[model samples]
Target: MDDDGVVPLSGGVMKAVRLHQYEVRPLVEDVPEPVITHPFDVVVRVGGAGLCRTDLHIVEGQWAAKSNVALPYTLGHENAGWVHAVGSAVEHVQVGDAVILHPLATCGFCRACRAGDDVHCEAQAFPGIDTDGGMAELIKTSARSVVKLGKGVEPAAVAALADAGLTAYHAVKKAVPLLHPGTTCVVMGAGGLGHLGIQALRAMSATRIVVLDRNEEALALTRAWGADVTVVADGSHVATVLELTDGKGAEVVLDFVGERGAEHDSWAMTRRAGSDFVIGYGGTVDIPTIDVISTERNVVGNLVGSYNDLVELMVLAADGKVEMLTQTYPLDAVNDAMDDLDAGRLRGRGILVP
Candidate 1:
């Protein structure tokens, strides 16, 4: 068995980046390769592991209590790779198949899984966060968590879609119905997910898109991605959006940056019956019940996404409708990648390749 108590692969040991302690930097070391254990298990040779802000939170002890994870575990959640091995019970995917993993490994018997909402499974473990993940040379995942990549899509290119892009797609999917040709949609924080959300809105609906961000580069990127208007996230940005929307405010506000009072400003720009979709963390949402009743506004929270949502996102990638800007790093540079992401030096998603 490996350190995670799962079946060990026959290749002896492979290089992996692991968390030795909470609130500390992770180290790269040699660990046993993962193997198929259960009848439905699948082992994948990792191609790309996305560096996400969530990983930084895990390192800062923010997720120590929430995830309840043990020490000395690999830590990359957004993963994509090639199927290297599978158990006898696995049937849909074959060896050598390129695939992207759903972040959550869920039990199909759970009520949430039956309803195709596996993100809320009763018995679920989040890869990287709760157990071993794809930061290593190989990883073990359930067959239910694997989605084969479509043609023209490579694992390294779309690995970030497993989480960041999927979250954007999920929130935008919910807000699409409320957005029409004449309606206005506001995107807060045109970062990785926000950039993807802009493209999703362009592909799914014809709503006039307005993006707000303090970073000029992010705003420029959002504009190139099809945002109808770009506003710097300052004191007057909400008023600008209101003016652009003919004094009625935007019909939908997607808050990708919920911290540092971004949510409060986003809510003010939402129309009377508009929906406020919250995707980022680190802040609390406090709206009075009276305002909720008077305006009939909704405050919705988004988790990462389901397996089907990942499949759909792959389609968009294959069609060139949505493309992720990835900065590649060798596995040995995992710490450097994390540092760049933390320092805000990276423009797009950071991908670590083995």
Candidate 2:
């Protein structure tokens, strides 16, 4: 560690899990605590951090070549905590404040930043992937990346909202302008991100929501979260979705699975000129040229949402309009949590409390 004499930067140490290789398990080890690197940085005492599917993919080495991260790095993006310290240049937040962390750090001078689309900032660094993350006692973050948690918002639930909920919020928000009252918005996959997507749509738009999932328990949970209809994703799912939309097809289809078959089904169930939003990261599909030009249907890819979108989502959660279903585990039981997530044994999102 550096001898800077800063309260939160110097002589700070913590424990975290580090990934060494693809398809390999992470090892929990003691590491130097994160420190404020910039004048606008703030140090946070993490209360809870979420384990997302993307973390699983990273362990499987799917994104190893694409991301700039190296071995022996911490892995966690969804995080919430109490402010432990702040840099001299920071003013939006102070010590002892409860806040939610946004994983992506974007350069405010980029063209995307100028347009208020910082999610696609030309220079972007992702915590947990591109850099160290919050699977620790304390983590450092930029003030712009920290959103204050409103009163009565549970820290664990807010951790789940960081990436999964924010991603769903951005994907669903894109299609909300087209989803009029009484129109159908079909969401494929009712798991982690999909479940939150259902709740975000319910809180943001007036459209009738339909959720599709292969698991019966997941479907039931979707229904409990305000989904108007839940359909099992069998081969006939397209027919069922179209029939529910009065044979005109759904106005907007959000595919969170991004599997080959699910993509095909989403295309078939969408109306002629409707939009198909793909939010998940894995899997590849073949899109025919004729289907794109003749029908005028649009296929859009979404990344995580901007900082403003995250703040708005927090407001909805603060108002009790959206419920974040989550299960907690001690930081030492991280391997068990990963196994449960991979086996689909967990009913809701899993969070690690350090």
Candidate 3:
């Protein structure tokens, strides 16, 4: 049988950008459009699909073994659009409704799903990673993954929140207990994911926010968005963070760029007994065994947000409490968008609209 949630298409074709090989450019081409094939399946007419570093990693073959995705699959994980059709048993959304999708389509009966921790659902299929994604004219997903957009919210404007923002929200939400008033939270990397972490931390807690990034523009942007301090990620970023935290280090550290030794710095910036949340991937975390026992630092790993987490994030977006900077491109410009993200040229999230 076909992999779960990736059944045979009924008919028709639509344009999509697909990666044919690793270390090669993806091309925009026509692919089979999606149709309802299951009782819970729903098809969405693509409005926007977010481009993230993980997409770059996928293109570079970093996720090839881990994802086990067949070559030439459509590559987009963060998606939002108008509902084109619904399955017979789907009751949450309908035709013409604008909605943002949770990144993974999960079986509702899994133990993790029953506990509202669907990110770890045993039978989960990550769309745009292991299967067809929404970087096309239309795509298929389960009804459980769709969250209807409220009035005044455009699908493209908030599509990246489906993954990038949701990830940051999930990390920050878990660290809320450590962010009480007078505590300090340091956010590493002010890019797509970390920027949202900044906004969510500010909205959810009274902790002072300090941001570090290799880009001055990103630092300035985060400062304007509510970071109490923004430091350039020069050679002395760790010392700078410790200095800003009165030499004790921050109570909580959010690492949005976990590669290039940022993982090491994230742990170093966390005060003793503080929690260090790792959201980005592709990095190794190596620490002395004695340090872990003596300092009592907690290194937490985060995945994409759950379905309920996405719902709460949308509430913040609806209240105007959370907003992300985004740039939109036509589906045909997928290569350009990918290059911009790879070079760190894009100031915010990049989205592809079809």
Candidate 4:
């Protein structure tokens, strides 16, 4: 190893999940292992790579125009691992340090990056989206995107928090000031991200939390996670949420499930002057012009999160205030993880361990 932190590479090969075409299952193929190539590059030995619904969308050609990602690339974005090697100038994280990735490698000098909103950095590289990602045995990232984990904390345990939990926390934190006591906050869905949103709300605010999910089992989990009420999301859920909120609606409605008519229902359950936050994607918000103008409701969008957000979320995780329920699959069984996610069989997040 060099005094500058650069380590010599072995020039080896490793297993990686690569998608050669859209609308088809990606396969586990032997690919060249990542190696440090830049002054700030840090290659991670992947411990866990989260299987996200967005990955399904990508495979279905949903992100084709937006990401413009070339095919035959690796696909796990929410990643956490140990630093297997680092570049010459990298110092914050050393080789063998446990860490979680930030999902985006950004130019630190950009206006958004300077303001801590690195998600919108002018020059950004979204691994697993537009470039090679962490679904492999090793992944290359920048030093700025790695957050060291606490002692005894496993990278696989918190890998999804890098994106799923981080996005949930970022959305919930934005509404913290609005979640005063006696205020009713409705969370739509209790899957991977929504469950974390419930826990984040439970930890950070005193607002009453009402969760809606199509699955009764998920509703039960929401209860154990500190929800004040739970509703089975069907055609009647909007009425039930309104009834729970005294014929009006919740001050904040977080739609973690944006598709399958959840968007309209979420908007319908929001208070007239309240805010509706959309975290999930793949659906259009089709409210009438009059509805927006007369109700004075605000529709807010959410991205992955910032570097500070990931750091703070880690503190919460380390203290045991937030934990994502995850089902682990060996790297070779990544397609099984994706199948469970697509079939809605996963109780929480699915993690691919390499």
* lDDT for residue 137 in candidate 2, whole number 0-100: 80
Residue-wise lDDT of candidate 1 within 236-258, one digit each (tens)?
89889989988878899999888
Deviation from native of the Cα of residue 13 in model 1, angstroms: 0.8
Better of 1 and 4 by lDDT: 4
| Winner of 1 and 4 under TM-score | 4
**TM-score, each model?**
0.95, 0.95, 0.96, 0.97
lDDT of each: 0.89, 0.86, 0.91, 0.92
Error of 1 at 1 (Å): 12
**lDDT tens digits by residue: candidate 4, 263-312:** 88888988889999999988999988899899899999998889999999
How would you encode candidate 2's per-residue C-alpha lDDT over 25-136 as one tens digit per residue?
8988889887665677788999999999888999998878888687889899999999988877788888988899988877788899889898888988888888888887
The RMSD (Cα, Å) of candidate 1 is 2.5
| Poorly placed runs, candidate 2 (over 4 Å) | 1-8
Candidate with the greatest TM-score versus the true structure:
4
Q: CA lDDT of 15 in candidate 1?
A: 92
Candidate 1, residue 219: how far the Cα is off, in Å: 1.5
Instruction: Name the TM-score of candidate 2.
Output: 0.95
lDDT value, residue 321 of candidate 3: 83
